[model samples]
Structures are given as structure tokens and as C-alpha cells.
Target chain A: MLDNLQLLFVWAPVMNVQMILDGVFVGAVFALSAYGLALVWGVMNVKNLAQGDFVIMGGYIAYALFHPLHGMGLPTWVIIPILIVVAMAMMFVFGHIVYQLIIKRVIDQDMFTSLLATFGLSLLMQQVINLIFGPEVQIIDSELPILTAFDSFVTIPTVKIVSLVMAMALAVVVVIFMKTSRTGQAIRATAQDPRAARVLGIDTDRVYAFTFSLNAAICGAAGVLVSMIWVIQPFYGIVYSVRSFCDGGGAGQFAGGDRDGVRPRSY
Target chain B: MKFKSLKTMVVSAAVVASVSMAGSAMAKVEGDTITLGSSISLTGKYATNGLHTTRGYDYAIKVINEAGGVKVGGKTYKLAVKYYDDESTPARGAQLAERLIQQDGVEFMLGPYSSGMTKAIAPVSEKFGVPMVEAEGASRSLFTQGYKYLFAVLSTSEQYLSTTIELAAQTTDNPSEIKVAMAFENDPFSLDVREGVVDAAKKYGMKIVIDDKLPADLSDMSATLTKVKALRPDVLIVSGHSKGAATAARQLEEMKVSVPIIGMTHCEAAKIQEKFPKAAQGIMCATQWVEGIPKRDSMFGSASDWNEGFKAEYPSYSSVPYQSAQASAAVLVWKEAFEAANSFDKDAVRDAISAIEMETFYGDIKFSAAGNNIAKPMFMRQIDANGNYNLVVTADDMQFPRKAGY
Candidate 1:
């Protein structure tokens, strides 16, 4: 521990920049994941244990899209952004189906019911993924060059930087959507008080469905970023879910008209 | 209430006993057929290699059955395996092993995909006095346990990456001046691989710059990669099965970790070459069997022939992993043991496996008292520019201090 500390602080302090940059890149992905989990938890009080599987499922979407285009020798930049958009749109639809099928049924139930339902969904998704993909760890090689500084000590993949910027841009788009959009206002009002929102000429069912589906889209976008940066496996969803749970703890506060509560996941 | 529950248990036990007695009517060897049971990792984390193992076993069975089957006691008996998915969990592996033996009436066993799963299943097989010929589980500690019934066909895992240190020492003028960085999963197999690297590093008196066990999730290795950047090590070794191999390969490229010697296990199983073609260049992948090895058996013809046959069977695999090769050899051990023992008795077959010395396409097969293969050698293949593996017998045939992926 002391040796690593010395290496970080004294021996090669320049490496600290690398760590910070890496952390930022990692934090960007977690921010999206946490934001989605928070949305579901804050809006409906439903702990979606299948949140990570949704992310993984979205990554598989990108992977499933990559191979056909890759064979044609299309550029990665074109291929990646297309896949991300397609995954998000598809996950949005998938999310609506899930909402109609599973989440809708348990929306009126207690937290435990929703949690168990999502947990079962998680197991089902993992098995489905394994059956389809054959358990091989997959990654989309963005094929971008690595940018380095400090005589090649602090190296960063161009995709990671692009992912960070994309994450920030997406975060901005989401915040604007939530703050200014009429449907977003309806969703937030429903989250605050479903009964009151329903009484005040708002369709709470549609609001809840939109909110959940929107969260799924965010999770899907994060999954695309994960596929570009880190490798994905069929059963690797649980870790992302665990991290999102910690980040979702703060999401609860963010739900209560407290934007200041939204912060980067510490770990 | 306790007496009433005990009475219910007694009645249940009696019913279970009658069912098992019926199940036992189909013995380990019945009607000119030998039934070998295994609880393999057909799903879960070890599923990739588990599929490879099952394919190997199936291919071996097909070939053996085609070649007039195993002649035992003046009768030819077809070899067949009954498998239950352990789900890559050790607890499930042990429970299934017991079920395979007691309920399914299996007296002979095949090992699971990993050292941990094998560790769990070994004790159950021992307790039941069932003989197991395992191919995949190769932790060195497993060999030290004095297991008479459990026989492993692969080289022990300590040989996995420790040999890379020897190659690293050869790259430098002063072996003692070489620095080693290692990140192994804290599992039974990878930990034992770590010990091998540590032992080799000690032998060369090399400085271990960084020794870290990444989280079992293995989603990231930036923490260790950062340390590697700060303190540039001569050699970086990682072993965490297919997941660890994939994570390390991806992260090293992302981090642009420029170590001279990068050794990893499960490069093929993870399909790192296909996944990260640019990053996979210059990775020293430790393997048990490659395509062109100079070993052959009557059953499988030769090593390359076996590779041709395997790829034909499993069309998806561009490169067959050694896990499958050794698995096929394990089935051969069963066939050879069955014929040699010339009896359906489990103890006789166990003795036959211990006494046998044979040659196979997977290489020479001879077990020491500890039940690990003593004749075979581990091979290191450097991933070439075109994603093909070229065998590196020495430092001369290799690219030392690899080109930075960045």
C-alpha cells in the first residue's frame, strides 16, 4: 500500500493524472447508470435489480449490430454512434414492453414485490444472453488511436474521451428533457405524488411508463459506452447493478426536487 | 413436533432408498455400456470452457465407440458420459457429484471445468470411492492432497506462467534486475498460477514491482494498470481464466500499458485475438495443446488431426482451446483404463488409471502418485500480427518487451 502511494505521489506523480482521467471516464458511465436507477427508484419506488441486465442487453444490441456493418468495412465512428442510437431506441421499446408486462403489474405493490420481480427478470435475461451469445466475453473495438502525454505514461483511448463527452452531452439532454418537457414535468409530478398527479388531470399510468422507459434508454446508452470501453459478458450485469444501487441511494435524494443530490458515484 | 418431523424424514428416507435401489439397477457398467458421470460448468462463469470440455468428451466418445468400443472382460462396451450442469458453482458441483454417484448410480467420474469446481467434486468422489479422470482442474495444491481416486490429465497450473519468468530472465543481462508485475484472480486456479509466477520470480531473484488481485468481477483493471504505468515492470502476468484474460487484454490496450513481456492464460477461450486484434499482438499465451504438436494416438491420429476433427465438430471455434484437447485425453484415459482393468469394478479401474503410461494426441499421459500428468509440457504461444499463435520454445522465437499497444 505504501509502495503504491509512493508511486502515485512521489515516484511518479504524473501517473495520478492517468488515474484521475480513468476515474472520470469510469465515472461518466456510472453517472448514466446511477441516473437511470435513480429515476426508477425515485419515480416509482421500485428497486430494479434487472437494471444491469438491461445495460448488458443493450450492449448485446450494439454487438449484434456491429458484425454485419463491420464486414462491410464501415468506419467505427459511424458504426458506433449508429449502434448507440439504435440500442437506445430499441431498449426504449423493450422497456415499454417490460413496463406493460412486469413493472406495470408490480407498480402498485410493495418494494419487495418489484425487487423480486426485477431479480427474476435479471436471471432470465442473463440466461437468455448466455444462450444467444454462448458466454464469450465481447467488446466493440472502436479502433481509435490512443492519445498519450508525459512521454507515453498517461495514455487515454480516444473512445473513452469520446464516451465521456457523449455522456456529458447525454446528461445535459436528459436534464433538459426532465426540466423543460411537459411529459417530463408530468413524470416528475407523478413521482412526487401519484394520487395528486392523477387527480390534477394527469394520466399517472402513462407518466410512469414513460419514466421507466426513459430510464431504460439511459441504461442502454450507458451500455453502449461500456461496450466501447470495457468488455461485456453474459453474467457481468450484477456488478453494474451493485454499483448503481450505491449511486441510486443518492438518486433518492435527487428525486425529491433536489438536483444538488445528484453526484458522481464515489467508488 | 420434532418426533413427528423425524417420522416424516424416516418415511421419506425409506422412499428415497427404494427409488435409488431401482436407479442402482443400472450399474456403472450395464448392458455393454460404461456410464461416466460429470458435473461440468455447462452454464455460469465457466460455461465457455465447460462447453469446450463437453465437446471434447463427446468427440472422444464418438471416436472410441467407432473404434470397436472398449474391450473389457471379453466384451466390448460403448463409453458414454452423463453430465449435469454445475452452473460453475463449487457447492453445486459437490451436490451434483453426490447425486451422480448415489442417485444416478455412477461409479466413474469426469472432472468439472475449473480448479475450484474440481476441488469441491474431488472430496465427494473420494468419499464415494468413485474414480475421476479430470482434464481441466490443474491447481498444484490439488496434487498435494494425496487423492488416490482423482487423476488429472493436464499439466498443473503453476507451470502456466512461471515459465514466462524464465523467458523474462533470459531477456535481460542480469536476471535479478528484472521486475515482475502480476495480477491474478484470488480464485483457486489463478492463485496457484500466481504462486508459480512468484516461485519463478524468486528463482531468478527478480523484483516483483506490483502484485495485485483484482476484484472477482474483473470488469476493470485500471487501478493496477495505473501502478504499472508509474512503475514500469519488465514483465506483466495475469491469470483469471477467460474473463480476466479478456479484461486484461482490453484494459491494457485502453490504458496503453507497454510492458515488454505480457503473459496471460485463456487467450483462446476468451478469443482475445479476434476481440482486440490490435491489443492481442505480442501476448504470450500459455497453452496446454496447440494444433501442430508432435504427438499422436491411435484413437485421434495426431494433435493437428484432433484439431481438424474438433473444428469440424464445433464450427464456431476458429481456434480450439487446450481445455478441450485435454478433455478428449481424459476420456481416452477412461477408455484405456477400462480396457486395462478389464472389469466393471471401480477400484480395479482406479488402479488401472494409476498404473497406465500412454501416448495421446494431447501429449504423453502418465500420472504421478499425486495424480497429475508428469510427461506433458505447457506451451507458450505469442499472438502474431495476423492473430495467429506462433509457438515460442525459447526467448529467441519470441518478441521480448512487446510493442506498446498505444
Candidate 2:
């Protein structure tokens, strides 16, 4: 036991700083996906179990653009932003279709029904993605250099730094849009009380559809950032879903103390 | 109305009964062919390696048939395989194995792609008293259960890193001064590899600076790599599947952690050399078979000759991964056992396999009491700068102190 203690002390200092840096970088990606999940759950009142598959699908979209476009001699700067935009646009349309085909039926049902429906959707999406992408692990080649600091004890990849900044920027933009935009106000009103919002001439259905699409767009952008820095697999979406579910639960607790005092249903 | 309905029901029941009787009369095994069954992961996470394993099985059967299939008791029977897709799920693999035996009436069994799947299917073979020759499952724990019917052609996971440790001890002037850091996935195969390395490290009097368990999905190894950089271990080893290898290679390059010798499992099988050339270079890995090993057999001929034929047949076969070679070798072992036993009876064939020992193109084939290939030795290969594997050490050769590229 004393020998084990000696070994533990030997690794304490360096492990602390290194692990903290690693956690922070990885946590930023988690925060982005979580925020997207919170947005849809807060507004639509439908628990989407396929949230992680959406992120994975978005990552594949970005991969398709980056690998093929780079092969065609397109510049990295030209490819990265285009990849994000294409992923978001594609996911937005996909979200709209999902709402029309499945989410609409479960929108007014009990929470358990929605959960079951979306869980089935998650399974379907995983198989479809596996079929299309061939189940091989893929990582985007950002080709970014590494940056070392603090006498090389702290090493950070430039791609990760870029992803962190992009995540923060997108989060800030979404927060501001929710605070000021008309559609965002309608979404908030519908979440507070769907019947009242409908009586006030707000189309709760349109608000739910738009809110779901916006959530997918946010998750899709996060997926793009993930592809740039980390590895992606067809079946990796469930991990993201579980992480986002935890984050969304925490966010719901914090939002429970809002001025409106509308308690979010816990699943 | 009652008389007409009763007559219709009786007529339908008679028709169904006749169909069942005819189906039962159909022969599962004929005088001309002997059938073996397998549950392969043709479409799932293990799909890529599963394809390689299945192709290996097919090729070996084709070659054996061309050479005049297994001659048993004055009769020659051609070989055929009946397989189902397992989707890389253990439950599904077990179910398919049961179906292959009870429904398809196959006498012999072939192993699945992964240790987990093999663990699931092994009990089914044992319960049915069927002998299975598996080529891919390498977890040492699989053999520890004392199952009589299960046998593996590949070396166990414990031998994966022993050669690297031996080479490191020989190459380093002061063995006691060596610090080794290892991170292995928390799975049966990887845990066995970790045990092997730790045991070997103790034998050589080396210090284990850091030991970590990689998560199930292998999402990140930065924390482990970070400690590795600070400790400045003389050698770094990681044991996992393809995903773990890719994660480590990517993180190592991102962190710029350089050690004198880096050894990892699955570098060749995963095609890490081609996928991440810069990060893969100078990494040593253990492989079951190398292309030009000085071993030959009448069945598959020389290693190079087999490789040449494989490439010609499978034009897209980039590299003869150890999985495919071992899979083919398993079939050859079973064929030889059949001919030696001179009977297709399960008891006779099992006895022949238990006592049999020979050399083949894949490697030497001799099973220990645990039914593992004890005579065969794992080879070590280093990924060169040109994104190609250079066979650094055969079974007996030792190349130590790999040059100063991390």
C-alpha cells in the first residue's frame, strides 16, 4: 500500500493539469450538443431519443464534403465553412421531414409515447447510417497543426481550439436569437402554455416545427465541429445522446426557477 | 355449412402435413459434400474484418476442393460453408450458431470475428458436442473455461506484447532503467494483453510508470498520453481494437508525445499505416502472419505464394490481414485432422485434433492442452515511412531499440 501511495504521488501534479485541459476541450463539444437538446425539449415538449443520431448524421455530412471536396483540390478555408452550412441545411430539412412524418403524431401524445417513438427512430437511423457509411470508423483530416504551451506540458490541437471557439460563437448567437427574435418569442410562449399561445393567434404547430429544426441545425453544427477534432462512428450517436440528456436535465432544473415558473417535465 | 367448413380444414391440414414430411426427408449431408456452419459478422461494426474472415474461409475451401477434398474411409467429400450474418451481436451469433447446427444440420463450426462473439458461440458448440476451429478469437480467458470442443488457430492475446518486451530488454543497455506505460481497453482481449505485458515487464525488471483503462468506445486517450509525456516512459504500448488504435495514433500526434519505442496492437489489421501514415510510422505491432515467413505447407503452399494467389483473386485485397490468414489456416487444420482421423465422426475428429500437430503456410499448428496454438509464434512488424509494413522480426529474430522516431 505504501508503494502504491508512492506511485500515486509520482503522477499527481502532471496528471491534474493535463487531465483538466483534456476535459475542458471535450466538455465544450458536449455543451454544444447539450444546448441543442435543451432547446428542442424546452420548446417542443417532445423527448427525442434520436438526438445523437442527428449529430452523427451531421458529422457524416461534413465528412462527405471535406473528404470529397479536398480530393477535388478545394482549399481548406473554403471547405470548412461550406461543410458546416451544408450540414446545418441538410439537418434542418431532415428535421422538418421527421416532424412531419413521426414527431407530429407524437407531439400531443403522452411523454412516454414520444420517447418510444423517438427511440425506434434512433434505431432506424443507426441502421440507415450504417448501411450508407459502411460501418467503418472515419475521422476528418483537418490537417491543423498542434500548439504547445507552458513548456510543452500543455498541448492543444489547433483543430480543437477552432472547434471550441466555433461552439461558443454558435451558442451565443442561438441564445441571442432566443431572447429577441419573434419566432423565438412564439416558441417560448408555446412552451409556457400551448393552449394560451394558440388562443393568442400563435401557430403552436409552426413554432414546434421551427424549434425542432433549429435544434437539429444546432446539433448538426456541433457534429461538424466533432468531425474536425475527433473520430466518428456510425454507432457513436448513443453516447452523445446520453450526454446531452444529462445536460438537458440539468438545464431544465435551472430553467425551473424562471420567472414564468413553468416546470419542465422530467423523463 | 358445418360439413363444408370441416372438409376444407381437413384438406388444408393434410396438405401441410405432406409438406412437412417431404421437408424432413430432404438430406442435410450427402455422400458428395460435407458442410460446416458459421455465424459471420457480415454487416455491422465488425463487417470489414468479417468480410476478410469469410473470404479466407471460402478461399481455403476452394483450394482444398481443387486439391481433392478430405478423403475419409475410401470416400472423398467436398467442403461447403453455410453461414448467417450475426450483425456483430453476441446473442444473435449464439442464436445463429444454434440454427446452423439444429436446422441446417452442419457437423462442424467455424468461429466468429471477435472474442466476444466467439465466447457467445463456444458454449453452443460444446453443448451440441460439435468441434469448432476458430481463427480469430484470441482472448486467453476463452480457453480458461475448459471447453472440450473449442479450438483456436491464432495465438492468444497474452503473447501479443511479450515479443516487444523481450526485444526492448535486449536492446536497452540497462533494462532496469526502462519505464513502460500502457493503456488498454477494458475488454477481455485487451486485458489479457495488459496482463502479458505486466508479467513480461516484471520478468525484465522494468518499471510500469502508468497503467490506464481506455473507455469502451475509445473516444479519448489524451489523459493517458498526457501522463505518458510527463513520465517520459522508454516505451508506450496500447491494446485495443481498430478504434482504440486510431484514437491513440491521433492523440499521440496531437499531443506530440514521442517515446523511443511505441508498440500497439491492430496497427496492421486496422490499416493504420495507410490511414494515418505520419502517426503510424515507427510503431511496432504484433501480427499473426507475415508475408515472407520461412514456413510452408502443401495446402496453402508458401506464405508468399498464398499471398500472390489471394491478391489475384481479391484484386482489392490491400493487405493479407492476420485475421484472413488465420481463418484459412483453421480450415486447413480441420481438413488435415479429418484426413488423419480417416473418419468424419465427431469423436474421432476431435481426438485427431487434440493429438495432431503439424506445420502450415500460416504458421506452425500445435495446440496446448487448452486448445490454443502453442507452437506458433507472433511476428512483429514496423510501419515504415512509406506507409508500408517492414517485417522487422520473424518468430525468432529480435530487432530492438527502434530508431528515435515516436
Q: Is the docking of candidate 1 incorrect, acceptable, medium or high quality?
A: medium
Each model's C-alpha lDDT? Answer: 0.88, 0.81
Clashing pairs in 2: none
The worst-scoring run of ten residues by lDDT in candidate 1 chain A lies at A258-267
Query: CA shift at A160, candidate 1, in angstroms?
Result: 1.1
lDDT of 2 at A26: 82
Query: Per-residue lDDT tens digits of candidate 1, residues A1-267?
Result: 998888888998998898899889988898788888888877777889999988998889988888898888998878877887898999999999999999999988987899899999998899999999878788887788889899988888899988998888888888777778898788777777779889999998898798789889988999999988898888889988988887776644543445422222222
In candidate 2, which residue ranges exceed 4 Å CA deviation?
Answer: A1-17, A251-264, B1-34, B42-48, B62-79, B313-317, B338-344, B394-406
Give the worst 10-residue stretch by lDDT in candidate 2 chain B.
Answer: B395-404
Candidate with maximal lDDT: 1
Worst 10 residues of 2 chain A by lDDT: A254-263
Q: How many clashing pairs does model 2 include?
A: 0
lDDT of 1 at A50: 91
DockQ numbers for every candidate? Answer: 0.70, 0.41
